[model samples]
Target: MEERQKIKVGISIGDLNGIGCEVVLKTFEDSRMLDFCTPIIFASNKTISYQKSELGLEINYNGIQEASKALEGKINVVNVWREIPAINFGEATKEGGDYAIKSLKAAVTALKNGEVDVLVTAPINKNNIQAEDFKFPGHTDYLAQELEGESLMFMVTDELKVGLLTDHIAVKDVAQAITPELIKSKVATIEKSLKIDFGISKPKIALLGINPHSGDNGIIGQEDDAILKPVIKEISESGTLVYGPYSADSFFGSDGFKKFDAILAAYHDQGLIPFKTLSFGKGVNYTAGLNKVRTSPDHGTAYEIAGKGKADHSSFKEAVFTAIEIFRNREEFTELTANPLKKSRLKREFR
Candidate 1:
C-alpha cells in the first residue's frame, strides 16, 4: 500500500455547463489540500482554463496525458478530450452530457487499471446523460455494474449516515422493490461498508419502514409487517444488531436516527429528504459497497446558480476529503485483517 499522503485521487469532470468545474477549482485553490493527496482531474486543459476565466479564480494545474504521471502537491489535469464543448451554464445541453460521460469513462478506466487510488465524481444531469452507452439512472447504478460489489447510495455526515435500499426509482415502484432478498442484500452491503469503509465494528443499523407508520399493523399497508419486520428480525437474530421497520416520518423528526450507527431507508426520497435537510452542504454522497472508493457532493448540478459564482464548494470539498479518508481506511483495514486466520492455524500447528 502507498503512504497516506501519496494517495492519488482521480476526478471526473461532470457537466461542463454546471458548477462541477467551478467547485473543483475552488477546492484545489487552497494549497493545503495538496498535503493529503494528489488530485488528477479528467478533462481538457482548454475547458479548465475557460472555467477558470469564467470564475476569475487563479490556480495552477499540471497537464498530464495519464493519471500515472500525476504529481504530488499539485493539481493534475488529464486531457480526456481535446475539443472544448460549448459551455452553456444554467442550462442542460447534450454536449454537457456527452463530455461528462467521456470524463467519467476515462476516470473509471484509470481506476480499474490502478492509475489512481480513488475517484471523486462531480454531479451530472441524469436526464441529459442518457445515451446507449450510459443507460443507468445514476452514478451508483453505473458504478455497481462497472465495479465489483452491490452499490448503496450512502449519504453521510459526521453525526448521521443514511443509505438507500432502492435509489433512482419512482415512488410507486418502491414498495414492490422492497423484497426479502433486497432487504438482506442491502443490509449486508451496508454492514460490510460500515465495517471496512468507515471503520465501524459491530455496526448498529436501523431500517425505515416502507409503508407509513410501518403499515400500522397492516391497517395502512401490509408490506411493512409482512416483509420488513420478519426479515429484520431474522437478520438481528443472526448477530448483526440490525433492527427496524420503524415509521419513516417519526424516525428522523423524533431524533430516533441518532441512536444507531447508520439507517437504511426503503427508497430514495425517504432517506435523502431528511439527510439533505439536516446536512446538505456538509454531506457526501458516497457509493458504498464497491471494491474501489467513490464519493460526490450531496447536491446536484445547481443550474440555477451555475456560473454565477454563487455556488458553494463545501460539499465538494467534503467529498474530496471523505474519499481520501475512506481510501486510507480501506488500506489500513486490509493490513490489519490480512492473514489472521492463516496465522491462527499456523500457531496451532507449531504448538
Candidate 2:
C-alpha cells in the first residue's frame, strides 16, 4: 500500500474542568497514531502537563507557536494561553469556558489560514461555554459563522448516519421551525455532503416524521402530512431521490433506517436519541456542508469521569479518524469530478 501524506489535524481543548484533555491525551498516547496525521493541540503545554500529571498519562510532543510549525511524525502543542489556569475536575468553571473558547478560536483561525488540514474538537460544556464573544448553542452554530456553507449536525457511524432538521432548539419551537425552505436547505446540504464528503455518487436519504406515527396521516397531527409530506414530494419530484416522513417510532426499531444512505430527523433529540442508541457511544459528530472539515465526539464532557482516567477515548479517536478520512474523500471527489467520465465509480459510502 502507498503511504498517504499526513494531514495536519488541529485540536481544541474543550472544558478544562471536564474529560476533554484526558481523552485527547489518551488518543495520541500511542506513537503509532503519528503515522496517520500530525496533531497540533491548541492549548498551553502547561495545561496538558497538568492533565497528564493528574491522570498519569504520558506522550512525547513538540511545542510550537503556530500550526504552521507543526511537524509530521510528532504531536505538536500550540500554546493558546500564557498562564496555567485552575483545573477543577468535574466542575464547570468560568475559566474553563473562557479557555475553551480561546483554544477553539485559535484552532479555527489556523483552519481558515489553511495551516491545518482538518479539525477534531473535544467536548465542551454548552451551558458554560456561553458568553458575549461565544453565545451560540454549540460548535455547529459557531463553526457556521466562522466557516462557509449551512452547517448541519450529522452524527454518523459505519452502519447508520443521522442528521438533524433542527438542532439545539426547544421542542415547543420545533413545529414553527420546520418550514419548507428549512427542509429543502437541510436536505440539499446533506445530499451534497453525502456525495462529496462520503464519496457516495448516488445518495438516497430517508426523512423521519415529526409527530408520532408520522401524524398517522393527520389523525395525530398535521405537521407531518401538511408540512413534511408536501416539501418531501416537491424535493423528490425535482430530482434528488428521497423517502419518508416515515413514522419516527418504528424507523430505527424496524431496521427501516438501514435501508437509506442517511436519515434526517425532525429535531435534535428526535435524531440524536436513536443515533446514540444505535452507535453505542462510538459516533462522530461531523459538521457537514462546511468548506473546511470539523468533527467531534458525539458525547459531551464526561464530568463524572473527568479525572478518573476511565473516560473512553473510542469516540474521540473516531472523531479524529473521521475528519482525516473525510479530508481524503473530498480530495478524491474533486479529482473524480474533474474527470467526469470516471465519476461513475467515485468511492465507497461512509459505512
Candidate 3:
C-alpha cells in the first residue's frame, strides 16, 4: 500500500458567536479527518475550550506556537485572541467580529507563507464584520484582494456546481456590473480552475441569463444577448466548451444543469437560490483562481443554532475532504509541470 501523504490544512474560526466552533469541533472529532491531513485551527484557546465545554464535545486540541510544530493525528491550534467575553448564541457583537477577522488574517498569512496546503474557513457574519478595517462584502472579495487573483465564488455539491459572476451586490447594480470583460474573465477563471483544482481536463460550463426567459430574444432585456452572447462565442471559439444564457427559471428543472460540469450565474441570487435549495446542508463554497486553494461550508454562521449541538458538520467534513483532494491534485500537477517530458506528452495528447 502506498503511504498517505498528509496535507496540512489551516482552519479559520469564523464568528465565535456562531456555529463555527461547533462544526469545527464536530468535524475534527472523527478519526477519519486524521487519515488525509493534519488540521491546524487559527483561533483563541479559550474560545475553543468554551465551545467544547458548551457543546459537550470531547475533542482534544494541541496548542502550538507556530504551524511548523503541528503534530500528526492531532488538531494543532494557533491561538490568536484571548479573554473574549461570553457570547450570546444568536447575537453579533463587535468583539466577535473583530476576533473572526483576526483569525482569518492569521490563516491567510500562513497560507501565503506555504505553511499550509489548503485553507478551510468557517462562517463569518458579514454585517458584523463590515467595519472600517473590514470593508469587503464577504470572504470571496477579501480573498480576491489579498491573493491578487481573478476570483469566482463557486458552490459545489455531488450533483451540481454553480459559479457567480457578481456576488454581494445589489439587484439594481447587477446589470451594470455584467460587462463583457468581467464575464469573459470569470468564465476563463472557472475553466482553468476546473482543470487544475477539480482535475477535469475539459470542463463543460453553462451560463445563465440575466433576464427572464433569456430576455425572450431581447424583448424583455438585451444584456444577455449583447454582453453574454459575445463572451460565450469568444470562449467557445477558443476551444473551451461553454453553453448558454439559459433562462434562470427553467435551467435547473430541465435537467439542463446535469449536462454541464458547472453553471455560471449572472448574479448571486440567480446561482445561490437553486444551489442552496438542492444542496442546503451539503454544499461547499470554493474560491477559485487564487494562488492557494480555499474552501468553506456553503452556509453562513448560524447564530441561532450556535452551541446548541444542533449544527450539522457534514459541510465542514466535506470541505476538509475537498481541500485534501485539491491539494493532492495540485501537487501532482505541479510535479507534471516541472517535468518537460510529461508536460510535452500531455500537450500532445490534448492537441
For each candidate, the alpha-carbon lDDT, in order, equals 0.89, 0.90, 0.86
State the TM-score for model 1: 0.95
**Highest TM-score: which candidate?**
2
lDDT of the structure predicted as candidate 3 = 0.86
TM-score versus the correct structure, for each prediction: 0.95, 0.96, 0.94
lDDT of 1 by residue, 165-265 (tens): 99998999999888999999999999998898888888999999998899899999999988999999999989998988899998999999989999999
Candidate 2: regions farther than 4 A off: 1-4, 340-351
Per-residue CA lDDT of model 2 for 1-351, tens digit only, reads 676678899999899999999989999997877777899999998998889989999787888888899989998999888898999999999989999999999999999999999989999999988999889999999999999999999999878899999999999999899999999999999999999898777899999999999998889989998999999999999999889899888888999887899999999999998889988568999999999999999898889988999998889888988998899888878877687665333233332
lDDT of 1 at 275: 96
> C-alpha displacement of 44 in model 3, angstroms?
1.9
Clashing residue pairs, candidate 3? none
TM-score of model 2 vs. true structure = 0.96
RMSD of every candidate to native, in Å, equals: 5.9, 2.4, 4.4
